[model samples]
Every structure is written in structure tokens, then in C-alpha cells.
Target: MIRTLLVGGAGRMGQALGEGLSALSSVDVVGLVDPHEPARLFSAPHFRSLEDVSVAVDAVVDFSRPDSVVLSADWCASHGAGLVVGTTGLSDEQRSRLERAGESVGVILAANFSLGAVLSERFAAMAAPFFDRVEIVELHHDGKVDAPSGTSLVTARAIREARERAGRVTAPEPTERFTLESARGADAGGGVRIHSVRLPGLVAHQEILFGGPGEGLTIRHDSFDRQSFVQGVALALAHVNDQPGFFSGIDHLIG
Candidate 1:
């Protein structure tokens, strides 16, 4: 059985993960680390800090804030624990720090843990070569602090890379000037535009649009609930111990 420790166990995603992991036969919750000690704890022991945990956990799953991710990674590596990271909005420098920490232990970091989201990125990359114009629209819950969802950025980057490899440049922009500042979305690599929407009812959704001569193709993925990520998280927790060093995205696990 995989002995697991969950960091940030008091948050929404963390609670969901704890509930999912509890139902799995191959896993056991060793400890929960959260700043605020929850009134009702899971089956595992609860600690306010990593230093307080007593058991030797096989892996650590993180669903905490981006600011805490690097420190958690470092603590995990130092304790000889595998890591599954789901925190988003990490700066390039923070990502580098995580990579460095991963040298001592296995690490899996992914922005969106839904399998459908991964497939959407793959489809967008596949469709990029055939079309000259592309744009992305991402919608998420209003409480999400990040402007554009990480899934959107990953999709746009993959599409851009594919288009570059196929020697296709995006079509020139039709308008040189805009009447309003928000008329056009933010610019992505290879001239792809990204639009972000924040709403109360949305969980997470993204659509990638590709325009050809006569028609247009759109690939979309919608995550109606946060529970969609639990399966992916479980998969990551199961496999993280087998791989050493830093890894990004769920594509590797899917393959």
C-alpha cells in the first residue's frame, strides 16, 4: 500500500483529495499537514507543520497555494518522500526551485489534473499545423486568483510549438489599433490570443479555436466539478515513487 501524506489538508481541493484517497485500497493516509488544525480530521494523524508528522510517508500530495509549493517540495525531498503537486500559478523561478529539490526525490507537478484537460492539450497541438489562426478562451470560478487558467497556457504553448515545427506562422492581425483596451485578449506565443473569463457557476473550461480557409475547428474541455481531478491525483500518487527527479504535467503518467 502507498502511505501518503497530504499537505494543505484543510482546503477545498485537499479535502476532496483526502476523501478520494480514503476510498482507495492501495493507499493509506499517514498524516495531514495544515496550518489550521481542522475540527474534524480524516483517518490520518493531523499536524500543523511537516516537522510534527511522526510516520515515514511514501509520498506527499500537495494542493496548497503556489507560495507554499516550493517549501513543501523541499521538505518532501529532505524527508525522502515522493511528491505530487497540484498547485498552480508558480512563477518560472519557483518552478526552477522545485526542479532542484526534485533531484533528491520523485516529483510530479501538474496544473490541471483532469485527464480530459490533458487530452484537450494534445488535440490542440495536433490541430495547430492545419490552421493559420488560433485563439483560446478559458473560464474558471471567480475565486481562482490566476487570470488565465494554467490549462489554457499549456494548450497555447503546445499549439505554438506544433505550429512552429510545421513551419506555419499565424495569419497577420486584421486590426492594427483597438478602440477599447479590452477589445482583444492577451497575446500568446505565435500570435495566439487568450481570453479569460471568471464566473461564479463555472468550474473550469477551455476552448481552442482554429480557423482554416472555409471552416473552423474548435476543441473544448469542460470540468463541471473539482472531483474530476481526484482520479488523476490518485494516479500521480501511485506512480510518483517510481520516477526520480522533477516532472511536469500528467502527460507522462497518461502515457
Candidate 2:
């Protein structure tokens, strides 16, 4: 069994993960790190920081703030433990830190952990080379801090790479002038436009629209509840120790 330390153990996702992993016997929650008072969500000991943990940690699962992820990476690297990061809105430098940890132990960082979301990204990449125009629309709850989301950015990059490998140029940029600044959504590289929406009712959803002569295709994935991520997280944890390096997507684990 993997003796795991869960960061952000008091947050919604952390609590949910604690509850979910309790049902499985492969992972044991050895400790929790959260600033919130009395992090009673789990039976494990709670600490304000990773530096306070005294027990042996075989692996770490981080769903905490972007700043906290760096600490988790460093601890995992120093402790010789595998790491699975689910935190979003990380800066380039923060990502580099996480990648550095992989040099010593297994590390998997994924933008979205829903199985359907991974498949949707794959489908979008497969169809990218055939389309002349492509755009993305991602909707999330208002509590989310990121604008376009890390998922959309990764998806855009995947689409861009797929098209490039096929020797296809990006969609043509529109010449029409806009009356308002930032009218058209943020450009996600490779001429792929991403429109972000934050609403109270939405959970997590994305639509990839592709257009060609006389026809269009739309590939969409939705996560109506946070539980949708449990399966993918479980899959990642199971294989995190198999290969000792950073994996940017869960697609590497999925068949």
C-alpha cells in the first residue's frame, strides 16, 4: 500500500479524495497538510506544513494552491516519493519545479483528471489535422481562479502539435476589427481561440469546435460532479511508481 500525504486535505477536493480513498485498500492516508484549523476530514494527523510531517510518506497527492505545490514537489523529491499533482493555475516557474522532482521520483501532473476529459482531448487532437478552423469553449464554476484554464491550454497545445505533424497550417485569423478590447476570446496558440465562462451552475465543461468545408464537428466533455475525477486519480496513483519521470497527461496511463 502507498502511504500517502494529502495536501489541501481540508478543501473540497481533498476531503472528497480522502473519503474516496478510504474505500480502497491500496492507499492509506498517512497524513494531511492544510492551513485550515482542525482538519478533521481524515483520520490521519494534520499539519500546517509539509515540514511538520514526521511519518514516512511513500507518495504525495497535491490538490492545493499553486504556491503550495512547489513545496509538495520539493518534499516528494527529497523524500524519494512519487507525486501526483492536480493543482491548476500554476505559473511556468512552478511547473518547472514540479518537473525537476521527476528527475528523482515519479511525477504526474494533469490539467484535468476526468476520464472523459482525457478522451475528449484525444478526440480533438485526432480531428485537428482535418479541420481548417478550430476553437475551444471551457466553462467552470466561478470559484475557479484561472481564466482560460490549464486544460484548455493543454488541449490547444495538443491540437497545435497534431496539426503541425500533419503539415497543416493553423486556422486563418479574422480581419474584422473589434469595437471592444478583448472581444474575441483569448488566443491559445496555433490560432486556436478559447472562450472562458464562469458561472455558478457549471461544474467543469469544455467544447472543441472544428469547422471545414460544408460541415463542422463538436467534441465536448462535461463533469457534472467532482466525483468524475476519482477514477482518473486512482489510475494515476496506481502507475505513478511504474516510471520514474514527469508525465504531463493521464493519457499516458489510459489505453
Candidate 3:
């Protein structure tokens, strides 16, 4: 029946997920674990901590902070349950903990779960090898805690991987010398540059530009609402149990 527990269920994303789950027929939201007050949209069991829950759930879907996410991973591992993580901005050590938990249970750790964002990442990777230079710009709401936004990082990584597969030792760099130290954006894995913008009006948006000799290709995705992420979360929840080890990104879920 896919008994799923929603972590961080009081947040915006969590509320959207609860609505999605309620509409689905195959999955049941068994409970919600969040330090905040009970989710106003959901009438399920509410828990301040996983330790307080006496019932056993088949899987956990996490949309919490980095610290709480690690603890949720541990809870899933100890209970032999599947875990789907949508939290971003985790430290390297925290990410490693989630990976290690997969030894005892299935884990799906994704930076961004919107289907458009997922597809944009794949498209950028596929076109990266043919381009001479690539850059990314990601915009998010100011309240977002992450700088680069998880979608940009994922897309940059995919772009870098594509170049590597093409036997390119390094990504093409900008020719202009930067007079200002902070003029250039942060370098993601594989030498891909990422520019992050956080403002009040923006929800989430990312643009990937691949430039060649005289042509350019641009892939873009916009997530105006948190509901866009729910379908991807549903997909991950349904398939996480089938995969035994740790998996990153929703690319595998689609392609």
C-alpha cells in the first residue's frame, strides 16, 4: 500500500505533497513528523520526532532541513524502510550519511524533484558535449536557504559528466580575465559555472546555456508553485523500494 510518512510536513512543499498524496489511490500518508505545529491541510498522525512514532511505516519522504534530514535517514535505515529525500544544501558529511544508510535500506536523494527541472538537467547533459562553453543561472525565492539552488548544481554536474564522457579533460573556460574576484559565478563539478539569484518574486527557475562556435542552445525550467514537485515525489516514492542502494537525482526515474 506504500505507507509513507512525510517529514517537514508543515512547510510549503510538505503541504503540497500532502495534497498530492491525498489525491493518489495507491499510496497512503501514514503520518507526518515535523517540529512545527500540525499540518493544517492534513488530518493524519502528527509527530514532533520520529522517536515518538510507535507505528512502522514502509517509507519516508523528507523535505526537511539538513540536520533533520540526516536523522530521518538514520531512522529509515534502522527500521529497514525506504527513504526519499528532497532537501538541498546538505553538507558533504550529511550527504555521506544518507548514502551510508542505503546499505540497510533503499534511499533516493534528489536535489530537485520537479519534472521540468529533472528533464532540463538531462537535456543540458546531452547537449553539453557539443557546446564549447556552458553556464547556468538559477533563481529562487529569497527565503530559500541554498545559494546555487539544487537544480543548478544537478544540471551543472550532468553537464560536466557529458563533457567527461566525450573525452574532454575539462570544460571550456571563459576567455575574459576577471578584474573583480567575484565577477564569475561559482564553479560546480566538472568546471561548469553557476550563477545564483535570490529575490522575493521568484519561486524557482533555472536556465542552462550551451554555446558552440556560432550557435547556442538554451534549456530552461520554471517552477512557479511547489505543487510541481509532487508528481516527481510520487514517482520516487513508488519506485524507491525497488532500488536497493542509494540513488541520486530523478533522472533515473524517468530515463
Candidate 4:
């Protein structure tokens, strides 16, 4: 069994992880690390920080803040524990830290852990080379800290990379001026436009629209609840120790 620890144990995603992992026989939740202690009782113990953890942790599942993700990576690197990070909105330097830590221990960092979302990314990349015009619209709960959710960014990157490999040129933009400022949305490199939406009642949703000769294709994925992520996290934990390196998405782990 993988002895796992949940960082941000008091947050919604952390609590979900705690509950979900408890049901899996392959994983043993050894402890929790959260500065804000959760009122809900858990089977495992809770601590303010990783420094307070007493058990031998084989892996760590972090659904915490960006800064905390770096700390978790450092601790996992030092303690020889594999890490599965679900936190988003990480800066370039923070991502670099995780990459460096991955050199010493296994690290799986992903923006969205929903299997459907990963599949959507895959589908978008597969369809990218067939079309010249593509745009992305990502919607999330208003409470989400980042615009153009990480999943959208990853999707855009995948689309760009796939088109590059196929030697397809980026779609041309005809608009030289806009009546309203920021009307065309942000360009996420390779001429892919991304529009971000935030509002109440939205969990997570994204759609990639592709336009071609006389036909248009749309790829969409929606995450209605936090539980959508549990399975992917569990899958990552099950295979993280298989190697010592950085995995940016769960796609590589999926069969």
C-alpha cells in the first residue's frame, strides 16, 4: 500500500482526497497537513505542517496553494516521497522548483485531474492539425484564483505542439482593431485565443472550437463536482513511485 499524506487537508479538495483515498485499499492516508485545522473528523491525524508529520510517507497528494506546492515538493524531495500536486496558478519559478524536485523523487503535477478533461486535451490535440482556426473558452467558479483555468492552458499548449509537429501554420487574425478593448480574448501562443469565464454555480468547464473549410468542430469537457478528480489522483498515487521524474499530466499514467 502507498502510505500517503494529504496537504491542504482542510480545503474542499483535500477533504475529498482524504475521504476518497480512505476507500481505496491500495492507498493508506497516513496524515494530513493544513494550517487551518478542519472541524470534520478524519480517520487520520492532522498537523499544521509537513514538519509535524510523524508517519513514513511514501507519497504526498497536494491540492493546496501555489506557494505550498513548492514547499510540498521540497519536503517530498527531501523525504524521498513521491508527490502528486493538483494545485494550479503556479508561477514559472514555482514550476521550476517542482521540476528540480522531480529530479530527486517522483512528481506528478497536473492542472485538472478529471479523466474526461485529460481526454478532452488529447482530443483537441488530435484534431488540431486538421483545422487552422481554434479558440478556447474556459469557465470556472468565481472563487477560482486564476483566469483561463490551467486545463485550458494545457489544452492550448497541446494544440500548439501538435500543430507544430504537423507543420501547420497558425490561424491568421484579420482584425486589426477592436471597438472594445480586449474583445478578441488573450492569445495563448500559436494564435490560439482563450476566453475565461467566472461566475457562481460553475464548477469547471472548457470547450475548444475548431474551424475549417465548411465545417467546425467543438470539443468540450465539464467537471460538475470535486469527486471527478478523486479517481485520477488515486491512479497517480498508485503509479507515482514507478519512476523518479516529473509528469505534467495524468495522460502518461493512463493506459
* TM-scores, all models, native as reference: 0.95, 0.94, 0.93, 0.96
Best by lDDT: 4
**Candidate 2 residue pairs that clash:** none
Instruction: Locate the minimum summed-lDDT window of 10 residues in model 2.
Output: 35-44
The 0-to-1 C-alpha lDDT of every candidate, in the order given, reads: 0.87, 0.89, 0.86, 0.92
Rank order (by lDDT, best first) = 4, 2, 1, 3
- TM-score pick, better of 2 and 4: 4
lDDT of 3 by residue, 35-119 (tens): 8886463667888899987777999999989999999999999998899999999999999999999888899999888999988
What is residue 231's positional error in candidate 3, in angstroms? 0.9
- Over the stretch 1-255, how does candidate 4's per-residue lDDT look in tens digits? 899999999988888888888888998988989999876536889899989989899999999999999999999999999999999999999999999999999999999899999999999999999997999999999888988789999999999999999999987897999999889999999989999999999989999999998999999899898888989999999888888999899998776
Error of 2 at 109 (Å): 0.8
What candidate 3 gets wrong by more than 4 Å, as runs, is 39-41, 169-172, 175-179, 189-191
Q: Candidate 1: RMSD over Cα atoms?
A: 1.4
Q: Relative to the unseen true structure, what is the C-alpha lDDT of residue 86 in candidate 4, on a scale of 0 to 100?
A: 93
> For model 4, what is the error of residue 38's alpha carbon versus the real structure, in angstroms, after optimal superposition?
1.5
Candidate 1 deviant stretches above 4 angstroms: none
Looking at candidate 1, what is the lDDT of residue 54? 90
RMSD (Å) per prediction: 1.4, 1.5, 1.8, 1.3
